[model samples]
Target: MNKKQKKMLIRIAITAVMLIALAFLPLTGIWRLLAYVAAYLVIGYDILRKAGIGIIHGRAFDECFLMAIATLGAFFLAVWTKSGDYVEGISVMLFYQIGELFQSYAVGKSRRNISALMDIRPDYANIEKDGKLEQVDPDEVAVGSIIVVQPGEKVPLDGVVVSGNSTLNTSALTGESLPRDVAEGNEIISGCINMSGVLKIRTTKAFGESTVSKILDLVENASSRKSRSEAFISRFARIYTPAVCIGAVLLGVAVPLLRMAFGADAQWVDWVYRALTFLVVSCPCALVISIPLSFFAGIGGASKEGILIKGSNYLEALAATKVVVFDKTGTLTQGVFEVTAVHHNELDADKVLEYAALAECASSHPISKSLQKAYGKPIDRSRVTNVEEISGHGITATVDGHSVAAGNAKLMKKLGIEYHDCHCVGTIIHMAVDGAYAGHIVISDIVKPHSAEAIARLKKSGVSKTVMLTGDARRVAEQVAGELGVDEVRSELLPGDKVAEVEKLLAEKSPKTNLAFVGDGINDAPVLTRADIGIAMGAMGSDAAIEAADVVLMDDDPLQIAKAIRISRKCIGIVRQNIVFSLIVKFACLALTAAGITNMWAAIFADVGVMILAVLNAIRALRVHNL
Candidate 1:
């Protein structure tokens, strides 16, 4: 409990003891009045003071007003007896204080829950210095410093492997209830636990610049951005509180006068009691507090799982998404290239590889990198010269007096080199020696293991269709789309072609159906921005991609797409439940209160009862993962 909560609990205990003593003692007149004063001072002095301040500020109608009227009425009731019903006055204040304590306790519990989620933010990082571990503030730790992370410790900074390896339990940040494997060259985000092994991670980003830091910053500010449901409750409370107070005042003055004017014997005291009870039931404090609390818990829960939803507006849009479009490379397939096969004529495969490496050394295409990697040999660089690039085609470079051309079939066709043995699944880069057929290297990218599951999960989340768009040829695109269970495939697209395809999908969207686009790192920035919800895959390493996408999956696992949709569905469901529950109960209680059928005491039950139920429901947002 916080300092404020501890103090409230202390006061509650004192009031409870006083109540017990008052019930047992048989004191007379002023002695009994002094007891009532003690009990009221212990429990409700602050409330009385608040009422007085509200009166001075010209905002005197609220819960404080209700408490003041109820307690003071009981004091006047004490005048009927020897003690002015001082015991009843104190007891009512005591019960009201008990309810306040319960609310404070609940608020403290919810704050603790969220604070536990934010535990991912570490206080310091251990920078390796001359083989000794030195502790420093995360912000003070410079980039390129090697931070040592041991088991059960959070990765305090974002970094790459300098040495050692481990499995990271990222439940605190990514909400994936699984531990991830990390090794040399693997990148790690801040806030994940080093479940095992001692890691010497070379920090790629400073503390404030890390993924966890940015996420913490986003979540900390989420409450300031209100959802539609929260806004409604705020406006309702504003109008409802003052209106109910006005009704209560008119009831106290007009109803007794009406009876007296009609020559009836209606007492002012009895009508005043009813008016005080009406004021107690009209606070509207509960709805105002819990509505925003629900969304706060929801977004906090999502942040715990490594999904950064920019705002609640995105959460709402994500819940309504019906069509999900995906970028082929990086988004679905492992964006890394590998040599799947080698086809060569008039030379052995090794000789073909050696020559291709020399020619491609002058270029920096992904396929060239794969070729150089496959060759497993270093390029002399001196053997290569006069490198020239062909737009959308290939590169021409002279190596050891031999003219080498490396590009797609476009260059092969343009050079009039006849090679018809090209396969459909992998990228085929043709090579020409002085404009003649030399050989071709086939590079294929493997699909991510999570892509298929991600697709299946999206289908479960009410997504009607999954589409893949890529700049790769139709054959490669078809091969990937088939493996990943994509419903539609648009391939052989340039950057413009991808944009046009997104426009087409937008046109096809229904009034009720929303469309989402997922993409490779930052290259699909334009398309990611165009979709209803732009989810960027592999959010951990690329700051550019993370900024462009509305929702970022820190680990770049496509399966998180489904998880995000599921979270949105759950959050939106909870939001709807609260709204429906509040409105139905509020309308019924208000009707019964306005009608003379239900008494003022019953009105208190209806108002306070509904507030308690709504608050309990709002707390469900914190436990969303269990749901």
Candidate 2:
């Protein structure tokens, strides 16, 4: 327990002991009244002090005021009647304190869960200088600095591994139990734990711009951006509290006068007691506290699964999502090219790759990288000479005294060489050796393992349409869409085209149903911003994509999109439940209090008991791992 919780427990213990001791004592009259007063002060001194401050500050229509007035009036009534009923007055304060304790405890528990999820903030970053390790604040580490992460250490910043290999414990960051194996050249995100082996990393970003810092900032500020429901509750409390207080006062005076004029022996004190009871019943604590708490907990819970929601408004919007559009590269696909098939002459497939890899060795394009990767050997640059790149055509180079060309069909035609059409889908690079058609290489980007599953889950989750948009060839886009079960495919789209497509989708979508667009490239930023909800693949996503997107899937898992929607729906459901339940129970109890059918006991339940139940219900938003 925190210090405040411990202190509250001690206060509760002391008050319970005193109440028990009084029951056994033979005290009466002034002695009994003094004992009750002492118990009340012990358990409720803070509440009484706060009520006094509220009154002095002209904000006396709060729950503290109602509680103080009701309990104090009970004490004075017992004294005026000369009855030994001090225990009832003290019991009211004691029980109210107990309810407050329960609230504090519940709020604390929810805060701790969120705190644990955000515990990825590293205390220090280990920088290596002059062959020695130095511990420095993460903020002091500069980009391109070599940082050493030992076994079991949290990665302090975004970086690429320069040396060594290890398995990362990303459960805290991604909620995945599987450990990710990392090697040289692999990029590692901050907030993951280095489970084994030492790693030398070159920092790619400053601490402030790192993934961990961004997520922490997002989670911390999420609660400040309230949902529509939460805003309504705020406005409701403002109007409801003062309105009820004024009504109670008028009822207290007007009711007794009306009864007296009717020739009935109306007791002024009884009517006044009823007014106090009315004030207590109309506290509005449940609606005021639980609606926002539910949203806060939901955001925290989604963050545990590596989903960062920008605000409660987005979370609310996600619940109404009907159409989900996705970008092809880096969002649904691996976005990495590989030499899938090699079709060539009788010279041999390895020979074709050798010519292609050597001709493209001087280029840094993705196709060049795939050629080199397929070659699987370091190039002999000395053997390559007179290299010339034809823009949008191909690259021609003299390798080992032989002219070689590696590019598309246009390049072969420009060289006056007749090339055979591969006719197959994907990127076809036709190669020419010494002015003769040598062969072709097929490079394709493979879809992610979970891409199909993500689409399936979205369909199962009630998404009406799943569309894929990309700047790839029609055949390739159609092939990928078929494999992933995407409902529609739009290929060869420029950045501007993507935004236009998203706008069209928005127009086609049904009323009150939102359209979400998921993308993970710098070019995807415009479309991400244009859509109703933008989801970015956080791990490998460009900074522009992450910044423009409303939600981020930290590990770049497409499945998280559906999970995010599920979480948002659950949170909205809980909020509606709390609002309906609190309002219905409150108004019913308020009617009972005004009708004189319920006493101070029912009023306490209406104010504090309802709040406790609502708070417990709000905490349910945090239990989203199962969903």
Candidate 3:
């Protein structure tokens, strides 16, 4: 508990003891009233102060004002009637403070859950200077500077490992318990702890642009984006508070006047007591506090699982997702092309690949990189000369004095060489050496192990449709879509084409449901922005995609998509449950209080009891690990 909560606890204890002692004492009249007033001031002075401030500021329609008015009126009625029954007013304030303390503790719990992520912020970066290690603020480290990460130190910036290898504890970043292994040439992100070995890294991004910085920014600003439900509650409270206050005043005056007109006793004390009871029961504290707390707990719970929801609004929308559109590469698939097969080799397979890798060595395309990776050897670029790259075709270069042409069938047809087409479910590269058909290499992107299960889970989680959008060939796209169990596939699409497809899906779906687009490429940013919710693969995703996305999966696992949806649905379910429960109990209590069927003690339960239950229910949004 915080200092404020501890102090409130002490005040509540003192007030309770005083009430208990006063109940036993045979005190009378002015002495009894003075004792009760002293207890009230001890427990509720802040509330009275707040009400006074609200009235001064021209905003006197809040719960504190309602509470102040109800208790003060109860005390005044007791004195006017000479009943010496001030216990009712003091108990009302006492129980209200108890409810407030529970709320403070619950809010503190939610904040702690999110603050766990804040521990990832690094204190310093280890930069080598003058043959010694110098610790400096991460912001002071420039891109391209070499930094040393010793054992048990966080990688302070996004960079590439230039020397040494280590096991990284990535739980803070990805929430996965397993440690990740990194070696030379591997890209390492910030906020991962080096667990085993020392590593020298060449910084690729400054501190502000690093992954940790972006995630911190996302978390800190999350609460500012309120859900529609929260906005509605805000508007409702603004109108509801003042309207109830007016109704209380009318009940206190109009009911008594009606009795006098009927030639019966006015019974002003009885009618005014009912009015005070009405105000207490209609305070709206349960609805005002629990709804936002539910969303806050939901966001905190999701962050614990490496799902970064940008706002409560996005969390609310995720619960209603009907269509989940996915970009194939780097989303559902590995996005890293690998040589799956080499066939129809006129020359040796290794020799054909060698010439192809050498010819395409100068190109930086993914396919070219795959070829080079398949070669499994360093390229001696000096041996290759007279290189030419054909747009939409391939590359031509002289390797070891032999003319090598490597590309698709279009390249072969354009070169007038007879090439044999291979029936393969992948991207095939036809190779020609010395103007002769040598062979072809097949490269294919592997699908993620969890992609199919992710789709299945989405369906089980109430998602009606799943679609895969990709710029890959129709054959490849169809194969991947089939493997992943997607309900629809839009293949061979450009970046703009993706937007049109999502728009079409948006029009086709019901207005009540939302469509989410998931992608990890720079080109995916536009479509990500156009969709109802954008989910990005943060591990290897382009910065543009992450920045444009509303939800980011730090581990880049497709299964997290389903998990995120489940978390949101559970949270929103709790929110609706709290709203319905609080309203039902509140209105029931209000009707009974106005009819004089319930007393001020019952009014305390109607106000504080309902709020405590709603807050307890709101805290359930934090327990999402099972979901």
Q: Which run of 10 residues does model 2 get worst, by summed lDDT? A: 537-546
**Best by lDDT, which number?**
3
TM-score of 2: 0.95
Candidate 2 residue runs with Cα over 4 Å from true position = 128-132, 540-542
Q: TM-score per candidate, in order?
A: 0.86, 0.95, 0.96
Give Cα-based local distance difference scores for all models. 0.78, 0.87, 0.92
Candidate 1 at residue 217, lDDT?
74
Q: Residue 322 lDDT in model 3? A: 89
Tens-digit lDDT track of model 1 for 321-340: 99999998888988999988
lDDT of 2 by residue, 152-207 (tens): 89999999999999999887777788899999999998988999999999999999
Candidate numbers sorted by lDDT from highest down: 3, 2, 1
Of 1 and 3, which scores higher on lDDT?
3
RMSD of 1: 3.8
Shift of residue 256 alpha carbon in model 2, Å:
0.6
